[model samples]
Target: MIRIVILLVTLVIGSVANINAQSKYEQGMGKAFALWTENKPFEASNVFERIAEVESEEWLPHYYIAMINALNSFGVTDKEKLTLQLEKAKKHIEEAELISPNNPEIIIIKATINTAWIAYDGATYGMTLSMKNAELYKKAFELAPDNPRVVLSKAEWDMGSARYFGQSIEPYCKDIERSLELFATFKAESTMHPSWGKDRAKEVLKQCKG
Candidate 1:
């Protein structure tokens, strides 16, 4: 009877341990995603670091960390600071790719990291990185063609690239027209989409003007 009781108790403890572990993993993933989606990268990075430690096999944490690092790199105008963050982002992104090579989101994120470099290089090297930026944005667009957010972001990047490449003077006006057209298209499509509505679209349009 004691043996039977001991065995049952062990089983219950094992089950409880498994549930706790799964709960921790899920909570970590959820927090990481929430922080990232909210654009709170510093907070997201902290959560992602915890997730990475807890679930090394899951690539999302590494991917988010890479994205945050890339954004931070772009936020700075200092070349050395930008390069250091870019390298860090590259490392994390490479690890994520290793974990999930075929993941579409990972591909887009890899392209995002490249965009930061493109922006930085543009500041330092004139138009040298403009083509590179266009190429990465195109790759991202191809990778996630159906995602409304991705489509909108790609169009915006193209508009920036057009200006950076000095194609903005068509006589000057044509580039502006194209940029406005793309922005309008994105605004309409993103706003009307069932999942994402008009408010964010209006904010984006306001940004375009300013």
Candidate 2:
């Protein structure tokens, strides 16, 4: 009877520890995201890198590092700086993939990284990077046909191609509209989950309408 009582107490303690860890993770992620949304990519990346190191089992931290770097690469004009950022983004995305293989969100991040690279220097990389980007997008879509984040990623890619590579925007307008609809109904599984991309989707929709 004493042994059973001790076991029950241990279980309760373990459960409490697990809940505390989750709460801490969520709070850290919230601060990191606030920095990111405030246009502080370097600060946000630092926070995310720390989270990724501490929470090695969680893939979201690594994914955010890649996503932030990729987004920042768009606004960077220095060739060397852009290359460095892209390399870091690739490394983080690769790590995230190792942690969560075949995950739809991770796949989209991989695609986004490649898309950003191609956008930065498509003239030099030519069709190879473009082909790989398309392949990754196709793989992600196959993995999660109804995922709102996937839809948003694909729509953003389409719009980017139109803006930078002179591709027609008409075909992607429907996709942008669909992504907006998807975003409206999307709900993240948890605070630490991938809850971004909706606001970006709204911006894309506006651009499409314009």
Query: On a 0 to 1 TM-score scale, where does candidate 1 land against the true structure?
Result: 0.60
The numbered model that scores best in TM-score is: 2
lDDT of 2 by residue, 109-182 (tens): 78766766666777777478877877888888899877877876776666666767777777887876787688
What candidate 2 gets wrong by more than 4 Å, as runs, is 1-22, 159-168
Q: How accurate is candidate 2 locally (lDDT)?
A: 0.71
State every prediction's TM-score relative to the real structure.
0.60, 0.78
Supply candidate 2's per-residue lDDT for 30: 71
Model 2 residue 50 lDDT score: 93
The collision pairs in model 1 are 169-172
Runs of candidate 1 exceeding 4 Å displacement: 1-22, 30-40, 123-129, 166-201, 206-210
Ten-residue stretch with the least lDDT total in model 1 = 189-198
Prediction-by-prediction clash tally: 1, 0
Error of 2 at 162 (Å): 5.9
